[model samples]
Target: MTGTPLTTILIVDDEPQIRRFLRPSLAAQGYAVVEAASGEEALARAAEAKPDVIILDLGLPDLDGIEVIRRLREWTEMPIVVLSVRSREADKIAALDAGADDYVEKPFAMGELLARLRAALRHRLRQAGEAPIFRAGALAVDLVRREISLAGEPVKLSPKEYELLRLLVQHAGRVVTQRQLLKEVWGPAHVEDTQYLRVYIGQLRDKLGDDATKPHLIATEPGVGYRLLVELAGDAQR
Candidate 1:
């Protein structure tokens, strides 16, 4: 929100006061603002305006914010930061699991809100042009070479295992839905075969020495898909 100019931001909230409050502040930071008062409007404006980031309110008139996140994620990877009055930690987890990048409660500090927005945008941009080589802790994956190593020692993987790992690495920090993983890795015919995916994931974990109980490399989202918990070499956490 602070660094670059002309970065469009979509504000989705039913309340005028909240929109008014954020409008000038975001504009002052050199962001172009688009407003939507309902869930339907939010989706429409998102496709039309093509905003760089979205500040979404959970209690929209039409659709729930979680649904919006899921629908948008089907085609787009734009950053979404939920700004809502729901203070329950469960709501935050649900939003993130549904594909929201960040969450901010109402009556929040303007500075902190702006800071979160900036971080989300920065991370999205980093994922846009991901490096061929990815690293987390001591594990390294050379995506271009289709090779993997742990603590500088070579690790071999089967064809299916490598494919699954590659998909997770592509969307490192974000949750990848089980359906998306199934269709991409095993093709459309095997999308309903969740058990097949479970077997392969377990196999990949064993080869990578990743413990499912207290996972450090691959973390599962229960009913959702997996996320690579590794850090990209040059992309430090903001």
Candidate 2:
């Protein structure tokens, strides 16, 4: 049998229709689903359900969705996917910064949502130090050997650049905050050094053959942090 147990997805939305729409979709994918209608219930059910991933709605009847994300982050790192009608960039950034793993606006395609959910889960597994090789499209990162290659060609990176890329690869699909990256890569004393990330990220993108204007791998979250998206690369599954 499989080493990992069945994954439970917690749906936190005040709208009955929303829950109904998601339940069967997730169930069809063999995921056990738990539903909560409000922020308070979301918190309680999250504790009771012990879900592996969470799909949260920001416009809850009681507490704001961001608040739910914040409270949950305090105790757990369960992958959270924020589903909301708010398409504004600021709202998306806020939810992400509050600890949501992915954000999908309302009227979303089911396929995209499912893909994002999978990425979120994959990210958590990688962050647990469970993976040695990470593959994103033609780019491959061999963490054990501290090597990165693009399309079979070895890409050179500075020590700091490699460290940053390694960390991002570990949490591949998740938005890693600037503070966390700085602290981890530059030391705790440099937590405020976001410019370091700006420069390094640029250098990394250039080396990885990624264009900042139309990035296929590393995408900026704008005012929050950066997220690496390599869906076509299979998100390190291989």
Candidate 3:
């Protein structure tokens, strides 16, 4: 019998050293590596390689990674895990909101970067109908029935709170920007209303028994957005 096909990963970074750095590591783990040095090249290569995942750097000679993400999203739903030197939370939010699956800062630990890559691949698989339930620690979300439970006990949530949590569950392990969450849940008119998010998130936390300070479930991304700490997993969820 033939061996399983390797998972192809596109490394889109203008820096040769960065590409060099990632190629061997990824190849060693049985991934087929494809490299692109510019956003334009990346677009072309993505079409040619049909990589299973993309590891992108925000600084490209031709176009910003965020724009690349948007352009790629126009046709494909492939997972993009960003690798950027940019430390600003705004940058992180921009990438995540633009359709990237995850982000890892520059000078990142190889272990962490590898973990993010694995998570992104898992996310794509989930999107492809592999996972319907999201779970992390004691939290459980049933996408089919729009049910949520903590430590085996049902947790009740109001409409807005449930909507927010559902959105997070949909993007589990990835950051969902504030404007995105607000616009999706509250409507376009409320996109800039941060206060509404704060109030509702607090209510959601209380109902889920997630601590505000030492949160174990939903972790606030400071000024960026919120990320549900799930195991890469679902649906309309009501």
Candidate 4:
């Protein structure tokens, strides 16, 4: 896959060995890799380099990766995947709640990491670009009008819920983190409020008649966040 025109990825880790191990492998897979050794540097490079995705290490010499994620969420919607030695679910949830799109434990498989990176990039692209109006079953979403309907009935949502649902619809097939959804809907100030997200998501699911257990439209990524798997057919023209 060398020179295959893959997206650029930034690797933020204090460990030289990690960067060394990742660079060649990522390059071999056709990604342009940039490295930053500290949170400060990562933030600066992210602004300047504008990497399509970020592989962030939670433990840094100068700052916590969560803080870095918080700061980055202020201005950018770029995908961030947390890489940490801490395998605890709480730690992973914390990162996910802090604007990380996904988390990977240390000593991870290179292929798995790369695959995750690709997914993140795909999600970002889907979110940023112009999305076609979508329909799945009786549900319909019009991107141009920012409207939604279910079973031939107009569904009303709060301003925040509408924005959140729009974002999920844009990224239809991909996972979106709580932090990303919060930032998009409530702004950066509310990124830490996971409960706010829970309530809004529940409201959305109820409106869509989505089953939490066997959800056909809205899918949850456990401790991560929610994704709306919009089925694009039939009612799109409406």
Candidate 5:
């Protein structure tokens, strides 16, 4: 009988060097690696391989990485993490907005990248199997009851605060952009009014007791958005 299959990760990049660097590193970590040199090939391999997660490079020889993300999102929700030399804030926002799960800038540390991969995988699993009660360490949100609790104690929040927290909880472990949050919470007219977000986020954070300096719950992504960090339900170590 065959043994358990390794979790597969598709590496899509135009540069041969990046692929060469990542393959062995990932394989050593017990991952089955798949490679694609261009956007078209990446799509083809994605369809054929049905890999668990994808690491995509934005500067592709054929299709742009954002477009590739759009196309793949059309068919599969397979987690896409963009590994790009493009460190511009706009590119990061565009990629995240287009459905990429995470972004890793060039000249990245292998340890950080590996941690991101694990986090992305965990995020995908969380999305696939959603629970009514969402837990991230000491934080917990009861989706069905519209309740908020931290460390087994009930937490009270205002309407706006609850909505903001609700949105964060809905997309736990993912970056929700300022534009997206502004639009959803305030409205199109208020999308440009970022002060509302600042005020509300502050209130929400305070109520949640999430420290701004060393945040445990909500993390600010600096000129991008916020990512609600997550942990195992029972504090299970990964």
Candidate 6:
């Protein structure tokens, strides 16, 4: 298969055999693979190289995987997939809270990992604004341009924030469940952290200047998830 022209991935793990196993597979699928053996090295490589995606191992020599993820989140928005032997629900939640986009158990199938990678890339592209823009009241979202404006002034969003908004906008008028949001935003391992969803949604609403008591564009579904109310009359093809 022909590789993605500009796609690159970083693999961070202490095991040389794991790196050796993943290098050729990712390369075969058209991704440029950069390897790091420790958490410190991973941070340095991530800062300098800025890979499009990261496949990280949770157990590292210098630091825990969650710390590495948190440190990376402080500076970058790249998709991070955590690979670990731990399968506990709390462990997964911690990783997601720290900013990992996805998590995979150890001894995972290569095909499944590739499929997850593809899904992540597709979701990223969609959020990056590959469709027509939409407008509602004083709020305008330029999907093609990947920009949001409130009353004509630009609204800045972090990478994760933008992704979350795009998901809402794309599924306007529907009640998106908390599990769905977590799965899409923080990956499959984070479907249970409702608090994270609440916090992020509050932040988004605040940033958009929407009243939490009476939101115009975003709405809460009580015990469920959130929804984006599309007031625009026309079909905004996306």
Better of 1 and 6 by TM-score: 1
Q: What's each prediction's clash count? A: 0, 1, 0, 0, 0, 0
lDDT of 6 by residue, 100-189 (tens): 766678999998688556645544554577557766677678877889988899999987788889888766544456777989999999
Minimum summed lDDT over a 10-residue window in model 4 is located at 229-238
TM-scores, each model vs. reference: 0.64, 0.81, 0.87, 0.62, 0.92, 0.58
The residue ranges of model 6 lying beyond 4 angstroms of the native Cα positions read 1-4, 130-237
Q: Give the alpha carbon lDDT tens digit for every residue of 117-230 in model 1.
A: 775776677687677787777778898999999889999999888989888777665566677788898899987798998999999999888899988788786765676764
| Per-residue lDDT of candidate 4, residues 1-238 (tens digit) | 4455667899999999999999999988888999999999999999999998999999999999999999999999899988889887678777877768777789999987876676566566656655567666788778788788888899988787788888777665556777788888888999899999999888988887888888887888776777665432222232
Global Cα RMSD, each model: 5.8, 3.4, 3.5, 5.8, 2.8, 11.0
Ranking by TM-score: 5, 3, 2, 1, 4, 6
Candidate that beats the other on lDDT, 1 or 5, i.e. the better one:
5
For model 1, give the 10-residue run with minimal summed lDDT.
Answer: 229-238
| Model 3 TM-score on a 0 to 1 scale | 0.87
Q: Candidate 2's C-alpha lDDT?
A: 0.88
Off by over 4 Å in 1: 1-37, 40-51, 55-59, 63-77, 81-123, 231-238
TM-score of 6: 0.58
Best by TM-score: 5
**Model 4 local distance difference test score:** 0.81
The 0-to-1 C-alpha lDDT of every candidate, in the order given, reads: 0.83, 0.88, 0.85, 0.81, 0.85, 0.78
Which is superior by TM-score, 4 or 6? 4
